[model samples]
Target: MDLHIVDLIESLNNFDENPSARLSNSIIISDYPGLISYLIQNLSGINIKILRQLLEYIPEQILEEILINETLPSKLIEHIKTQPPDYDSIKILSDIYDESIYEQLVDSEVLSKLVYSIQGAGPKMCENLVKVLVFISKHKMQEILSIPNSRNFGEILIYRLNRAQGIEKKLMLKTVTDIIFSFPDYFYINDLKVVCDIVVDSLSNQEEEILTENYEALTALMDVKDFFDLKYRFSEIYEVLQVPEGNSYILKIQDRIYSMISN
Candidate 1:
């Protein structure tokens, strides 16, 4: 074994022996740039549990530096692929603002794994996975749209939308909105219509926050170039907003849609 590897392992072991020593250990690691580099470079050899612990104490700026390592993004994807979803790792990856990490993710075909993992995921995992998807869609829309299975991925998003609720559903809606705005041509007519239907259906939701998201999602859909052809799909919106006295909030949303389509 390399002497440096042996020394790192020993030091990690010592940190494990005294859990409360994390503050001092993090300080020592941060003061030595070489040690931080060595740790990041040899991440594959280190135990995940230990790495997760060490990450907690690392300063945010230093952690951002560590995240920029080209290998780290791929490694995080591989870890999610080979093991059950690691919320911490996924959350970290989602928080990464580096375009290089997103490029690595695109090259690795991380989308399919992320979508597949959404099934049967707990709330936190689902939130992180969707956040990552949203991030990729925002930064690498063209690459994602060019993938052969991109349409299938869209279908999965719609399917999940049908089954999701509350915040998950809202996030899913935002992700779908982002993709549609970026690649309106990619979705078939029926897909576009279904998205319209989903948004209109969500208007009945009583939660004020969800109702607001539904309104925003609806307005976003109307902005899609393709949505004009499918505007009839939202014919039901008029019926939904109709009231004896007319609720002010619902009326406002109705007015916005009418104003958007008329312009």
Candidate 2:
């Protein structure tokens, strides 16, 4: 074994499950490959405790790079699923936006695990998970929404949207709207009324960006036969534009709503 790998093993072997042990001989970015190799070689004996601690210290970029690679080991993925999904790492991975990574994630069942695992994860982690789902939806709209757990994932996002505020709320709205715009078939058939209702409420929000995104999504929804339910909400939509301080974007939203209802 390489001297550093030897030292790393010694450190793990000597670890007493104490914080200080984690601090001692900690894995850095350069050492991740060695750690991954060690984990792969000792899959049966891979120490979950040590692996969790190591993952906490691994850089987000390195973790994402590993996930994006075609050779990402199942053992490593299993360990990652065993642990809470890291928000920073998921965020980094979400930025890659490749269909292969999406396919691999679905193939390995990592994406489903991540989606189902959202219930107990922290709010920020849940937000990042939704962000990752949104990115996946952008490339593989049908593939992602068709996951067996897709409705669960969508429900979690709607639940989060209900409780989110400020930028977090905007992000969730963007994600939901992206789905609504891109996959009208799934959006209409899926039990996604909560998502649609929340987005409709957001159309009346004071934030221009949120209102614009929601209106554009609604406009897209207008093209779908089943989404005429939004017609009933036009009164509330026009009410929002009644605000005296409305801006140009608000006027555009008004125009959009008018065009949809008129035609």
Candidate 3:
């Protein structure tokens, strides 16, 4: 037992559960190969309470790193499914987007049902669906739509979009749009134009940091032109941004948007 390893465990300060105790038991495991197997044997009680307890003690950053670095054990995952996940707990999980953890969670017959179990979850469920949808394979698209949850997901997405800005915000909106298209039934489908207009208007007010990164995304939303108006707006934007001479990718896209639909 290295003294520094002991220190890290002791530094945890207020840990008071079996899972916390078990995780503490692994203080030296990171340095020792095969010790996790032994530690797993010692940890007979890895229930949701225990797992959440571990989540509480570990910094979310470290938990994210661990989830990415290792395979989530099936037993541990099944436990996460048994209890309704705490909102904060789910928030933590959603922050880290590891492909493998996604695979494991989607495989849970229990979680698979719960992912779309929007009735009880309400607004929170919509956010959860958006988070999970990013990692969904194409085959699962139908199953996701079948969840019967109302389009509360759209509101959750809009909420996040309102908060995010620049490239970060643009990527989030693009992800939402992708999810929206995949589960188009969740929304009126016709309502996409409103969403597009909202996003474009947002870009209209933003600093160039966002416009440079999101010009194309905003313009592509024009593909569904029945509801959105882009020609005048894109023209105004191109003139304001000065089109950068022959390298005007934004201008070209705007031109394409114009050709796609007239007034």
Candidate 4:
């Protein structure tokens, strides 16, 4: 039988909470083309969870189709930048694979709005938002970093990194790593110096996960030849790791960086 999304949507509206999941499942399992665009264009004030569920059903080609519209990026960004930043919807959106849509994201000031949302978010919600930002950077680092406010982008991320704790802090460090390595030419030397400082502090975290991530990030930053120009900071970083009888893992990180810088 031929299926229509509007009919499915109406069926969804008529159902009470109990059966909605079943109906949503039916729609998703079908994987019809144009379904995602239909939802975006026709739906208004839809619950973000429902929207995410629907978006998750969409294949990547359909997602690219939805973004082909000039207006959709701004609409999607506005939807994501809601009062708390919609984590589920943004998460689904972040998986977008098309490179062309990233230009539209920059035009919509997605980076600026994400930074604003990060400023006030409590820890739980902040991790979700940071994940969305990280995914965007993962996919579109060069395009997003090329924009004029990209330094502000780096600074905002660093500011968050400075105050973040637990898992959120690890996510921020990974985002910083992506930024530092992906667009070294986009950020100024001074901005990188600040990032190096943050990575140095992160390396001192006792958790092995954070330590491993910071070590990898620090290595990437140092691999950039310009980072070596700031040679004076190396001893300070080494000394920070030298807190008498630190973890053996931390010592290994120190030894690795020492090996690199010594050569």
Task: Give the alpha carbon lDDT tens digit for every residue of 1-263 in model 4.
Answer: 23576676666555443553564466653444455556666434554444554445434434555556555566666665554455555555555534466545544456666656555556645555555666567666666566554565566666667777887778778877776676666656776787777767665654555776677677767767887766847876765554236577756766888787776
Candidates in order have lDDT scores of: 0.63, 0.60, 0.49, 0.61
Q: Which window of ten consecutive residues has the lowest lDDT sum in model 1?
A: 23-32
Which TM-score value belongs to model 1? 0.52
Candidate 2 Cα outliers beyond 4 Å, as residue runs: 3-131, 147-149, 164-172, 182-193, 200-205, 208-211, 221-227, 230-233, 241-253, 261-263
For 1-263, candidate 2 gives per-residue lDDT tens digits of 67887778667766654544364447666776766566445643334345444445444634554444444344445545666556544544444445554445444366666676676777667766776676555556566677776776777776777777877677677777777677666544443556556666765555655666566666665666676654645556556543236467756766776766766
Full candidate order by lDDT, most accurate first: 1, 4, 2, 3
Model 1 per-residue lDDT tens digits across residues 147-173: 665565576677668778887788778
lDDT: worst 10-residue window of model 4? 53-62
Query: What order do you get sorting by TM-score, best first?
Result: 3, 2, 1, 4
Candidate 1 has an lDDT of: 0.63
What local lDDT score does residue 37 receive in model 3, on the 0 to 100 scale? 32
lDDT of 2: 0.60
What lDDT score goes with residue 37 in model 4? 55
- The prediction achieving the highest lDDT against the true structure is 1
Model 1 segments more than 4 A misplaced: 1-21, 24-26, 29-35, 56-58, 68-70, 78-85, 139-174, 180-216, 221-256, 259-263
Those runs of model 3 whose alpha carbons end farther than 4 Å from true positions after fitting are 1-65, 68-76, 108-114, 117-129, 137-142, 166-168, 179-186, 189-194, 207-213, 225-249, 260-262
Better-scoring candidate (TM-score), 2 or 4? 2
TM-score of 3: 0.59
